[model samples]
Target: MYKSKIKNQKLKNNTYTIAVIGSHSALDVCRGAKDEGFKTLVIVEEGRDKTYADYFKSRGPSTSSGPTGCVDEVLYVDKFKDVLSVKIQNELKKRNCIFIPHRSFEVYVADYDAIEKDFKIPIFGNKFLLRSEERTEKVNQYDILKKAGIKYPKIFKLPKDIDRLVIVKVPEKARSFERAFFIADSHNSYKHESETLIKEGKITKRDLEICGKARGVWTKYMAQKRVFDTGLLSPTEQAELCQVVKNKVPDLEDLIQEYVDKYLY
Candidate 1:
């Protein structure tokens, strides 16, 4: 049986207390709380490095590894609610402490809220509201683009909608060019590159899949064609040609107008 803080006079047995769950980033919050004279503990998934424990102890309270590190005491438990068992709850009650879960693991929100209500301890931050705001922001970006009439490539919900030569991607993974491909042209080029690399045994099929998955969304080459040139190029002749094309392509103005509306609104 682990003794509660009530037995420790230095703690005053009435100090503010918190438990951070899931992420290493919570160490910052734990250190801040300790500076404010709060009893802080951190919980993480098991088998994680104990570096945070050493860091937190050096700053404030003595640290121990529970799952992730940065804890005052370590306990190996899988579920967050396991910390609310009779033994643990009794320890908490004796210490006059509250438990606060980290915001990064949105999965624990409901459990944290339930524990807060049951134990009459405050759970810091509105996880539900924050998640709602994040979801709304993602949907609103698409809505704004649509309202401004920006020409986004068509989105496909099903694999069947993808052409045999088309590319498929996950939206969150679509940030970098290294993850992207040119579809038929890109895939064929990749196959050639892969064969050369395979002879050297440098890259694997798994690597290629990971690269493709990271790209998340794909666009056809035809979809990326520019209708007009900006005409600001140097060397006189090229600039003159670009200006002539710009004059002829009225649709270019409409595209720029759409971008201004979407971004500058």
Candidate 2:
């Protein structure tokens, strides 16, 4: 049903546009496309168009001097999911747009089947990769990482098997996209924190039990007490680690506190 560049003669004109949902890495995608001298389009929801329509909007296609901003055009829709509508798809095809997927696009669109089979736009990345972002998906990021032989945190099959400090990663009850992370040194602490989080409405008990044999199955990393670029500890572990370094580096705790305040909240 969808006519790609190979099938459409209009797309062979060489005037291609880069298009993306107006969230997550939209600015980065638009900026990169603009750098390469291509027009960039951002599809935004009603209340979320300001960033693309005003802040980073370009003056014109190109000027005597140069382009002003990254976002060349902004198409406002009632919702991000509306981008899958026939009207939007037709408009994108007319522009010869290569749609780029991001975290926000996958989350807001919320329909993997439509993205794969219904929406007819030429996607820049593999649409199947979008499903992998969800932890519930059969073939997820963890599966991909394992297949690639990439070293990640070891998952404990059972809570009792946890011999070292490990972080428990689970989806938040209210927000499935966000993870509720906590660190535990043993089964007792793990159970305690899990109960506490359940009481606090941070996570669902069913998800805690079903996600991995042990709730820590998702992300149970050994706390080697060293900072590495590969893995970052939970906020709780970071605070605890900062306390140990506070005595040696008097200002370290303050800096860590500043970082947590600025970013973690």
Candidate 3:
């Protein structure tokens, strides 16, 4: 129904604006939108509006004076969640804005149901995909990857199955969003690392047991590829992997092109 509304209404002055929350990937999103000739609007928290509304605010279209910053408009809200308010949504609708969700949107809005059902704006990407990041969700990224037949890291069902170099991933004791890892190659090594972490108060014993126990992956293969084990992802390897997937799954290539043609034009 919301999509129908977007399809039926003519944009004001035939102008479309790209809107995004003012954190995480906001600068990148706004910059890309402005480069593509779309007006950019950022919804920022009151204290944080300075970056978008002041520093990167657009001076006007590009000119001989050199390039202006990307952001065109900034809407200040008391809190990020205020963006879901009907008043805010209506204001965005008046400007013919299509929201582009990012990390901040999922982290601050934090409610998948509200984002999918209550927020009545046209979103440029799949909002439902946001919930899949939560491992506690009934169906998550791992499940989706498995169904798509995408090759991901192998999961050990038990600690005893860990026989090669492996990393136990767990959330930091204070910062849940950030991951803390300890490498181990066997049951003894796993126990030793986990105990060290617990003794250092870097992670809770419960979290180490529940989250790290069966999540260890044989990461020597990744190290051999000079990837994740090095604590960095190789862009070259990433591109090659993508190409391999596209060649192996012809339907996925078509699906990606379809999305690009429909949403990106």
Candidate 4:
């Protein structure tokens, strides 16, 4: 059963409304909401409406896909912030819609400082803890999880010794989102990763030497990392990811290493 977060207003239709930006994927939030009986309203980038529609068209219930794809409606816009425009407001009003912002969309929304803005429609979830892209005084997502007593992987500046569980990541402020790779247990492995990251221009040797400002204060470079996208790893990179996952399950042992060696190496 679909539990809609659109509150107060009793929309007489069987259709509950949800708004989302279409990200490229077969299984995504819009598809889920649409399957769960909500009339999904997609807000897509100008050229991407077709791309998203096509992707959705490849997979839809009962009738197959296309303009009538998976979602109930698709709205093209110049930018996500334009979601606050009167044009959007009119559309939103028609459905008494629930604005459902995904993580990527919410980042842009937060940049525009768009609060619900008197549209009088309910949002379909808990309040968004807006992330500050600003480097200074920004609340690191990892810190919040830590404060909540969540267990997370070790995070710290590159050190003489790397953690048994490790990843090479870009510092938070850059948001370039340098890829994460397992920092293998051996010192040679750590050095190899450093060289690889430097080669890929993901980080500099200097970045490892000096994280954040030299004010003697520990910065977010020393903070926990958000989850890495293991699926994004290519064959050459999957061995590192395999190593990371294998560390969490030691019993699998040589079987994991053999698979990575045979396929990913």
Candidate 5:
């Protein structure tokens, strides 16, 4: 069984130790630990792109096989479960190591809780608080926008909403041309050759040709109205943007505040 040490409790040995698992984006953490004179161990998957390894090697740290003139050592663990095994846990315990899982792996509340319970190591960030705070902030921001009467385009989810002159947007995998569409309001509309709209009889071969002629995948079905682009960023723009973002994505601000509170302040 693992024992819990209170916050600020020094390690048995004056030396600090840290094990970072799946550390893709948390390279800074490893670097920081090393700078702090901690015996740092990083475990990454072998099949992954070797950018991380190359980075560490170039920096003259260590290799996965063992220590190589770096701060400590690097280990290439093939599986996630291997890090939690008895052998690995025993080794970590022998060194009184703290385990910090990589943030890019979609960490869950249960994962942090389990690590704290099983390994008796402190994982930065409260799982439940962070998740809840982010969700609440987003919802609140959406509500604020609605209340402030900011006009946004109606979100269409169905193909039937695609009239002769209608815009089609693919939000998830949207790119340059895919980001938005301004369909011309025409009585005789030509349909584009999109698999989604093609099956719905919304587009035809002629439409495909026209769309192909255009720079992007979305083609205007009808002659569009003259729309002025009022794209100026003013003081009001900045304030409104900040308010909207704070209301909708409060968690982002919260995270910044958390970091300041923890490290800076």
Candidate 6:
């Protein structure tokens, strides 16, 4: 119940109130909300940032718990679910706030009924947020991509070409599998390790068989080809990209536009 900003300010029933969780991740929604005359409330667990929260001490002393620019008030909570509880949101008492979550906290966005039931705060989000959060539940994304006519690298065969430095990788869907994290440069190393793990009883024959089947991710995309990727990703660009996508604007599509409109030539 941090009330420094709200102490004297008139709490409006008509003006929209936006509650942001990942201020570093989805700052656009905060700025946009403020621009549209919506009161912004940023919620921080330990006063962290929006994206990864690795080293996000981005806030100044004036706000401390919250960042400036788009934020009106900053609220800190000991627990995540507590903020969603009616007992906690009742601390806001009369102010009407819409909980529009950023992508970093999109998991909570999927819990629409529970959040709405407890906080009675309407989110200005849609089913797309839920879909984004449920990406882990989907293991058939490659099949879906194939259906979309998107091309992928060629699959490998056993006793395949090892001299060419064939790539062995885990499928995107099955990347969570404990043993699938490795990426071997050549077929020989991959085969040797798989067999070694099976022999050591660390992986069973059935597990090996299943892994082999799913190991179609081993592709011949860069077979003997020296590839040079240009402008792949930079820290500043990626950071800007992360900040821009959380709201509805979507990807560098919106950010690039913002840059051109505001700063670029």
Q: Which one wins on lDDT?
A: 2
Worst 10 residues of 1 by lDDT: 241-250
Q: Write the residue-wise lDDT of candidate 6 on 157-201 in tens digits.
A: 553554443444332333223333233446676777566655655
- Report the C-alpha displacement of residue 150, candidate 3, in angstroms: 1.4
Any residue pairs clashing in model 3, and if so which?
none
Return the candidate ranking by lDDT, descending: 2, 3, 4, 6, 1, 5
lDDT-wise, the better of 1 and 6 is 6
- Candidate 6: what lDDT? 0.51
**Local distance difference test values of all predictions, in order:** 0.46, 0.75, 0.74, 0.53, 0.45, 0.51
RMSD of each: 18.4, 10.8, 12.8, 10.1, 16.7, 13.6
Write the number of the candidate with greater lDDT, choosing between 3 and 6: 3
lDDT of 5 by residue, 1-265 (tens): 1334422233432375766764443455565565445666666678752545565642433555444323255566666556655677677777767766543432422253344445444444433333222211334333444678985444333344445444443222222122223243332332332554556544444444443433223322332223322222543354212111112112334545756886897
In model 5, the Cα lDDT at residue 224 comes to 26
**Which candidate has the highest TM-score of all?**
2
Measure candidate 4: CA RMSD: 10.1
Q: How close is candidate 4 to the true structure, as a TM-score?
A: 0.57
Q: List residue ranges in candidate 4 displaced over 4 A.
A: 1-15, 24-27, 54-69, 84-86, 107-121, 130-137, 161-163, 171-178, 182-192, 203-265
Model 3 gets an lDDT of: 0.74
User: Cα lDDT for residue 142, model 5?
Assistant: 32
Q: Candidate 2 vs candidate 4: which has greater lDDT?
A: 2
Better of 4 and 6 by lDDT: 4
Q: How many steric overlaps are in each model, in order?
A: 4, 0, 0, 0, 5, 2
